[model samples]
Target: MGRARFAFGVLAFGYAFLYLPIAMVIVYSFNESRLVTVWSGFSFKWWQALFANEAMLQAAWLSLRIAFASATTAAVIGLAAGYALVRARRFPGRTLFGSLVVAPMVMPEVVMGISMLLLFVGSERLMGGPDRGFLTIAVAHITFSIAFVAIVVQARLTDFDRSLEEAAMDLGATPWVTFRTITLPLLLPAVGSGWLLAFTLSLDDLILTQFVAGAQSQTLPMRVYSSVRLGVDPQINVLATIVVSVAACALMLSGWLTRKKV
Candidate 1:
């Protein structure tokens, strides 16, 4: 009983430690103060200001579009890579291929960002086209996010039963048909999880996006960072609150979907 009590106490402390600051941010978002730390009664003025900021709104929309595109593209590529890693046991250079698939997950983001930036610039010089903007940012996001998605899918695939596929094949189904009708259905939860993770990563990334993004393609993180550099405003609090709310909703929805699928 003592040990259980101690463990519960520790868990409570850990949660409080992690969420206390976030709680403070949410609380202060409603404060009617230009001075962020000071509370001068509750007001929706900052929320109003956040909506009124055209640059912030545009950055948010751009970030969402990039995240959606990147997550979808990463999911497709990652699913194929994961399938190959699991289903192909005797492929040529399998070790090297597996290493390459997962390398980006552990590789330093700064290094990846710089390398991608150089690649894009060099490609532009060689081909005399393809400017740095939305497409570049989406491609950059996919580069790193694909590894995360692949890792998730690969984990799920590792535990999967091969008998299901074999049974489908014995029933005169083609490999593609077997995969689409049997394997894909069983793997839907993991795929959805990977896509959500990729989406969140793309939305939260700053360093990589900074390297690839152009003046006209600034994202919400970039805008928030710039605003914070000039000192915290009430609007920044409102923006952070909105982000936290959206993230919470996404997490809840993902949880619901996972449970329903199960």
Candidate 2:
């Protein structure tokens, strides 16, 4: 009983430590007062103000576009990498390829951001394309996001049954047909989970985004960071609430999809 009590107490303390700040943020987002330290009852004024803030709204819209594009591209590439790692018997540089695909999953954000920045700068100098704003940011996001999706996909494929594909190919279907008609449908849940995970990573990324984002390509996270530096607004709290809600929903859905049976 003492051990159980200790475990429960630790769990409760950890939960409170993580979520108490988020709960405070959510509650303060509705404060009627300009000063966040004091609550002056609830108000919808901040929500109205958030809508009126054009810079924040524009940055949010741009972030959504980049996240969507980056997630989709990462999903496709990660799926291919996962498939190759699992399904293919042997290939040249298979070990190196697998290592490269998952290296970002454990890599530091600062390291990745600096590396991506240097690559983009050099590429722009030589090829003279993709500029430094939207395209560069999107590509940077994809580079990191791919690792997450690849890890998710590789885990899913580890338990996958290859007999279904083998049976299809054995019966008169080509490899491409078997993959499209049989494998893709069964892998949809895992793919969806990976995509959502990648989307959240890209959307919430500020460190990496800061390195690649140009002056015109400010994202929602960048906007929020700048706003907080000047002083906290009720609207910043409101934006935090919205972002947290979105991220929570995405994570919950990703968990659901990951657990879904094929």
Candidate 3:
């Protein structure tokens, strides 16, 4: 009984430690004072200001667009790569290809960002095209996001039963038909999880976007960083609160869906 009680106490403490800062951010978001440290009174003025800021709104929209585009592209490419790795046997350079697929996940974001920027600039110079902008940012985001999607899909594929796919193929089904009918259905959960992971990564990214984004394409995090450089504003807190709330809802929904599947 004592050991059980001690374990429970430790878990409770861990949860509090994780959530306390988030609680503080949500509470201070309502502060009426310009100074975040002192609580003058509670008000919705910060939320109102956040909604009224046109530049911030535009940045938010652009961020959403980039996140969706990058996530979709990443999901498609990652699904193909994951399928190849899991299903193929005795392929050429299989080990090297697998390492390349996962390398971006472990690589430092700063190095990845700088390398992507240089590559885009070099391409533009050689091709005699317009300089980097939204397209560069989207492509950079896809590069990192694909690694996340591949990781998730690979985890699911590791436990998958290969004989089921073989059974479908032996029963007079073509390779494409077997894959579409049998493999794809079993892989749906992994695909959904991968897409969500990719989307979240794209949305929350700051470093890579900062390196690749052009003058006209500022993401929400970029705008927030610039604003915070001036000083902490209550509106920034309000924006953070909104993002936290949305993220929480998404996690809850994912949990509920998983539970339903089980």
Best by lDDT: 1
Better of 1 and 3 by lDDT: 1
lDDT of each: 0.90, 0.88, 0.86
Write down the lDDT that model 1 would get.
0.90
Give the per-residue lDDT digits (tens) of candidate 3, residues 137-159.
Answer: 88998888787777767777888
Q: Compared with the true structure, what per-residue lDDT tens digits does model 1 show for residues 106-176? A: 88889988999999899899997479999999999998988888887888889888898999999999998
Evaluated at residue 219, the lDDT of candidate 2 is 95
TM-score of 3: 0.94
Give all TM-scores, in the order shown: 0.96, 0.94, 0.94
**Considering only N, C-alpha and C atoms within 3 Å, which residue pairs clash in candidate 3?**
none
Worst 10 residues of 2 by lDDT: 253-262
- Which candidate wins on TM-score? 1
